[model samples]
Target: MKFISWNVNGLRACLKKGFLDFYQEQKPDFCCLQETKMEQGQADIDLGEGMLEYWNSAEKKGYSGTAVFTPHQPLSVRYGMGKEEHDHEGRLITLEYEKFYLVCCYTPNSQNELKRLDYRMEWEDALREYLMELDKTKPVIYCGDLNVAHREIDLKNPKTNRMNAGFTDQEREKMTTLLSSGFTDTFRFLYPDLEGVYSWWSYRFSARKNNAGWRIDYFIISDRLQNAIKRAEILTQVEGSDHCPVLLELDI
Candidate 1:
């Protein structure tokens, strides 16, 4: 089955820019969306028939949010990690299928001034614990805007972006910790030698035009699911948001 993930920046705006067209073109078995920046009742999106849509909207309208669209119904669905404060932002949504758990998350950003770095670290710890607990029960297929460029190969100019929020040492280390705990970065597994491949780009400084971008969005699966991953891709040509779509195809 094919699974896809993308941070649409804003669902409303993205729709106008051909979100539906891309969705129809890909026709993935499952699709996870992050940074929707919309709340229930604010806008209506028709995804057509035969697809189940689940949304977790932040309490703050037009902020952080996530949604999952699946052709196969999940056995159960969960929102967040049961943390009252963290749940407010609608950062996480997990769909428990018979075989594996699919988690879509919009990780908290450290912001431009680095004022939220402490909180971001706390989130990292909590999220890691949550994923580990879930992994104990079943293998996981996690995706979305993880908001960190894991290594020097993940971004165009890692040296210049070292102190940046998404490239900070602390943030990257958290990603390392997650990967060390039996999760595989699917894209890297497929294209270890590929360069200048990125999923997200800045609107400022003509970043995308110059191919200055970061591979922040990801499709990470448990180590046990590594062999199941048939293909992993970054659809850089698909435009609508600052971030592009990441695709993963699994035999299961």
Candidate 2:
């Protein structure tokens, strides 16, 4: 099965930039999106027949949100981690299939001045606990903008970005903690030493032109699903948003 994840920045803007054409061309079995930045009924998007579309929109308009599009119907679907406070932003959506659970997440960013670092850390803890609980029932396929460059190799200039939101030590450590709990970073599993490949780039400074970006978006699966990962890819060339698509082909 082919699975893909992307942080579209804004679904409305992405669609205007040929998102539908790109979606049709790729034809993934399942797709997850983060940072939709839209509210319920704000815009209507026709995904066509045979595709199931599910969205969790934030209460705050044009803010954090996530969505999932799948060819197969899930046995069950859930929004958020069952926490009232965290559920409001619509940052997570979980779909349970026969074999596994697919979790689409848009992790909270620490912000430019690290003002939200404390809250981001809290989110990490809660998210870790949620994933662990789900894993006990079945293998999990979690993907989307994790908002952290786990290692130096994940960003073009890690040294200079150390203090930045996504590359900060606190954020990186949280990712470490997540992976330590029996989850495999799929891209790293396939390309252990690959460099300069990134999924998200800044809109400022012509970052994409210079290929200066961060591999913050990812497809992370439970340890048990590691052997099922046929191929993991970063589709840096295909773009409608600031971030490009990351693909994972699994033999499920």
Candidate 3:
């Protein structure tokens, strides 16, 4: 199966910026989107035919949200982690298939001066526990804009960006803990020595033009799924949002 995940920034705005064209060209079996910022039916989306759409939009209008488009119907669909504190943002969606659980998440940013760092830490811990529990039933394919640079090599200038919202040691340590607890970061597992490849670029300071980006988006899976990883890549050339899509292909 093929999977593509991108933080479209805003689906409504992205539609006007060639989102449809890119969708048609990629034709992934499943397309997961984050930061949609709009509720379902708010925009008319014609993603060709045979695609089922599932959305989890925030209670607040025009805010954090996630959507998934796929040709295959899931056995069950779950919205959020069932925790009131974390469920309000509409940040997560889990699709259960016979063989695996597919989770698309839009992780919260720690915010300027780490104002939301405490909440973000709570979210990270909760999400990790959720993923691990799900893994016991089926291998999990967790993908989205997780909003953290896991290691120094993941960003353009780690030294200068340390303690920033997405590059803080606290956030990075959480990611490390999750990976250590029986999950695999597919792209890194496949290309351990690769560098300078990133999925998200800051819109400021000509970050994209200068290729100063961060690999915050990811396609992570249960450790047991490592052998099934056929391909993993950060589609840096694709444009529409600040984040480019990350691709993962598995021979399941």
What TM-score does prediction 2 earn?
Answer: 0.97
Candidate 1 clash pair list: none
Worst 10 residues of 2 by lDDT: 39-48
Q: How close is candidate 1 to the true structure, as a TM-score?
A: 0.98
Error of 2 at 133 (Å): 0.5
Name the regions of candidate 2 deviating beyond 4 angstroms: none
Scored by TM-score, the top model is 3
Give the lDDT ranking, best first: 3, 1, 2
- Candidate 3 — which residues are off by over 4 angstroms? none
Sliding window of 10 residues with minimal summed lDDT for model 3: 42-51
Question: What does the lDDT read for residue 39 in candidate 1?
Answer: 74
Residue-level lDDT for 106 in candidate 2: 97
Task: Estimate the overall C-alpha local distance difference test score of candidate 3.
Answer: 0.96
- Quality of model 1 by C-alpha lDDT: 0.93
**Top of the candidates by lDDT:** 3
lDDT of 2 by residue, 1-252 (tens): 999898999999998988888888888999899999986467777678988888999988899899998889999999999987679998999999999999999999899799999999889999999999999999999999999999999999998888799988889998999999999999999898999999988999999999999999999999999989999999999889999999999999
